[model samples]
Target chain A: MTKKQLKNLALQSYTKDLLDQKKVESVARLLTRFQLKQYIRELRNSESQKTINIVLPHLPAKTDQQMLSRLFAGKRIIYHVDKTLLLGIKIIDNDQVYDLNLKDTLDNLFTFVSSGYD
Target chain B: MIDSQKIIEQLENRLMSFGVDKKTQNMGVVEKITDGVVIASGLSKCFMGEIVAFGNGNYGTVLNLDEDTVSIILLGKEGKLKEGDGIKRTGKLLSIDVADTILGRVIDPLGSPLDARPKIKGARAMPLERIAAGVVEREPVNTPLKTGLKAIDAIIPIGRGQRELIIGDRGLGKTAIAIDTIINQRVSNDVICVYVAIGQKQSTIAQIIDRLKEEQALPYTVVVVASSSDPASLQYLAPYAGCAIAEYFMEKGKDALVIYDDLTKHAWAYRQLSLVLRRPAGREAYPGDIFYLHSRLLERAVKLNKKHKGGSITALPIIETQANDISAYIPTNVISITDGQIYLEPDLFYSGIRPAVNVGRSVSRVGGAAQTSAIKSVSGKLRLELAQYRELAVFAQFGSELDATTMALLERGKRTTEILKQLQYQPLKESLQILSIWSVTNGFLDDIPVESTQRFEKEYHEFVSSRNPKLLETLETGEKPSEPTVTQMEKITREFKKIFSF
Candidate 1:
């Protein structure tokens, strides 16, 4: 498989179980083979551009009013309620990132696995 | 063959461009000139580099400083200095580059990579400054940082974000424990580890790199090395550079661990530079700020509050005590600065405590909160039993033992000693398994004879191995052993004791 195909496969495998089966099938049908190929190509090219755009997850149990206010605050950022990113919001632009989530920092700190005395 | 006259004329022209009031201290004493660098010394060593450009006033940054007397850092091109010439300095020291990327990768004290990898890849660099963490921002350590070694984890618990000093004589596995901690981080990829080698052998550093590579632990680990062969200036900055690298991760709200393999050499290196810089010396000819030097470095290893993303920098500052004297200046200063200490005893090491950690006095002031429930439950009893055993064993050596309880305590002590005597280089996971097994085995501790307890403990381990392999699996992952698992271990130990009645 091509690199694009592999990346799509990996992404699909990671996110597939999260979506409802019918929704996944519908989403898959929305993108034809040619569109899928184009999407893959765009993702691959964007990966090499040294710039990234990331959507941040909303705070847990945010009120609808608060959500609407944040969405239309004239800022070029948006928050979606994706539980997979844990409890934080991350915005990636250019080569910099703005992380407003507690989970990311906790995750990074907890990732160390060495076992000797320090 | 360049003429001295031409060289002097070029020098005069360069000096004139700098607007310097040239006194022409001595003229017409034509000296043979070689390369661009000039070296002439009558009263004192003088070095002159080609004048690259003119600076403000009579003082300007030259292209090159005198090669013999002063080393100059040059910027841009147009400069002239002959092989045999003299240049006067404005009594300024050259500046060196310092950065956060200097951590993890094996680099000379001068910030040059010794591993031959590409240069450091950080965007920001800073000068080495001695700064301490602020009082209001500093918090008491409460989180336990497990080392996977029972002796250390149970007795001398190291807390997350604590500065724990490991003090021992040379060749007592001080660096081994530090390296093992770094390697153990592989089990939890969330922990970023940095190992700083100060005044260590280059080949020794190379071996450490090889070991890390073998374990595939290098990706998340950084090695900062300052060998004895490196210039004193580099040694002086080694620990600061290591801390800076750790700070990069900490500021980003990540937990980072840095190990200063030993600080004795770093102190000596700083002393050398201090003397060179004309700083006054104190006890042992070290600068008066020697204590402050270490305190500031260690204080930087802090745990930020939850509001600031709750990052932590845990420092393992190793110190080598001369002849086991902990009261020495360096040792005492480090002991007071760190959160706790792991005191390695030569006698215990000879008695086969692989880590040689003297449990009687070594402690982690705040690490008790971080231990697993199972460890906390058993560790208190274990320490008490071991202490009693030591006291009794000493009396028994003089043929004074007379009671069944004393004999039982001695037996339990032997078994505990054997269990704690882990083999060298046993990965953290294995050590944890062995420790947990010893902790939960109550049957083995109850009736075993003091003389044959070591043998019984060995047999008990063999018996458990034959009965259940999952015990090892759970320990390898650092997961708490389930109640059922503990019950199974207890049952197995009981059955083994019944089957192999002494």
Candidate 2:
């Protein structure tokens, strides 16, 4: 197919996802692996009540959990521990991720310094 | 060779300057990787043109922002980027640090030194893509940006803010003209030069740098190289990066000249990036924005008005045409964008015209405004005379009978062409250029054999300088020679011819 036709196909798939939210999960299952990921991400951004995943190098305190629950009020939270983060937390909400980590900070600092601070 | 110790020290100082804050980064997961473009999801907060870091320690610029994913064009290697790999937005656009320290350095598009020298400690960062200066910020181009070649300086005069294209077929001395212009800038300290070598062979770039060094032009020059071996992203970014470096100087009330030693490769690199991103292709499979790509870049070379400090960025962009076809896509786009063009011809090159500039096709839109009074006085009618001679000479090639006027015109044109023949890398001073043109136009070389004109010019310059130093000074002042100075010059020329037998 020509590029334009392929682009139209992709557009149609996303349009279908937007038009019928309940059919998204079923249509996503029938899609290829890449297409399914894209479809699910698009569907998640279409509305609220997202399934948010929180990963941290260590367990959060009770106070931190209370704050997190309040921040994502309408969403369902899934928790996991990932040691690679070194410290701090990664919150994944479908197409949006918020990373507050020492690893990312240090990496950014190194890139900033190496690239010359102007 | 980065001075890691110095960089570490500076980093410590920078760290001390930073105040602690809650750091948050928008993250993405790599969905697919193909041909230096990464399709990633979870970066819904990522804005267009933001710099993103891949899990593999690579960095890329976000190009396409979609409903589901962001398409990033990698600035570095894509070797280890995999599906499910994480990416983070830095919330910054692509920029390069530029400073006076960058002068005399060979740098990549990222402003990193490639010559194994110390890392540049720049005071300012210039973003790669910038809006062109508005019309209110500009002034008319009045001063000449001399290339020091008689053919160009006399006829196709380039102004301080002009965008003059050097165009021809491959290997037809386009780079030679640009290099000569750079070397000629060594005569003046006011204008700094930036040479951007895009997609050229490394060996060729090395040779050019070595030539700049040999000419002592490297001291005030910056060489930005994105060789053929580099990824298309860097090659595409090279010219804009070079322009950014030049703008640093131009905005500081200093004159700057920038040469993109052929943008055809730059266009090719951009085409590759666009195709990889799957953008719709236009004619020749190039993206529709191809014309906009060059227009924006060329428009930035402008002369700011007196209120804006009167600094200028003169661009001499070279474009390689196939079979001398200026009608081709890239060549025509550049030609229409530039103020004028110096069109070199293969036939003229083979015929031993070093610059090989086809005067018929070549023109300076700046006209006589860019020329010094000394040169303008002598070259006022030179272009018309040469054009007429060319037309008559073509008819004369049929072996038909010709009038005396036609014969004289042809002979004068031959001597004029011969006098304009300059040696490679040996750019003449304005004084010498005027003297040479003055000698020919004043009919001093009419009786001299055409073959001996070069020798006569050399001897005449030496004699005049030794006998009447004030004449050269007058020419160098850029003023029209007084009637007495002209009379003295004529008298000296007649005496010199009499004293020496040819």
User: Over the stretch B119-219, how does candidate 2's per-residue lDDT look in tens digits?
Assistant: 78735989999999999999999999999898999999999999999999999888999999999988877899999999999999999999999999999
Over 4 Å off, model 1 = A1-118, B1-104, B130-139, B430-485, B495-502
Runs with alpha carbons beyond 4 Å of true place in candidate 2? A1-49, A56-67, A82-89, A99-118, B1-12, B20-22
User: For all the predictions, what are the DockQ values?
Assistant: 0.00, 0.36
lDDT (Cα, tens digit) per residue for candidate 1, span A1-118? 4545644553453242232455445545667686666544444333423233445454435574466456545323334565666654655432234455566555433332211011
Candidate 1 C-alpha lDDT tens digits along B1-502:
9999997785565444443222221111112222221223221222232221122111122222221123322221214433333333332332223345554466654455677776664345443453655666666666667676768877777777988899999888888888778777777677888788888898898898999888777888878777777655556667887887777777778889989977999998777655644457899999888998898889899988776677889999999988999999999999999888999989988866788988877877775666666566567777777788777878878887478877766766777776676555554454344444464345355555545654665566677666766665664454455787667766766677788766
Q: After superposition, how far is residue A81 of candidate 2 from its true place, in Å?
A: 3.0
Residues A30-100, model 2: lDDT tens digits: 66776665455544444322567899998888998889999988666778998989988888776556668
CA shift of B126, model 1, Å: 5.2
What 10-residue stretch in candidate 1 chain B is worst by lDDT? Answer: B21-30
DockQ of 1: 0.00
Q: What is the lDDT of residue B42 in candidate 1?
A: 23
What is the lDDT, from 0 to 100, of the residue B105 in candidate 1?
66
Error of 2 at B53 (Å): 1.2
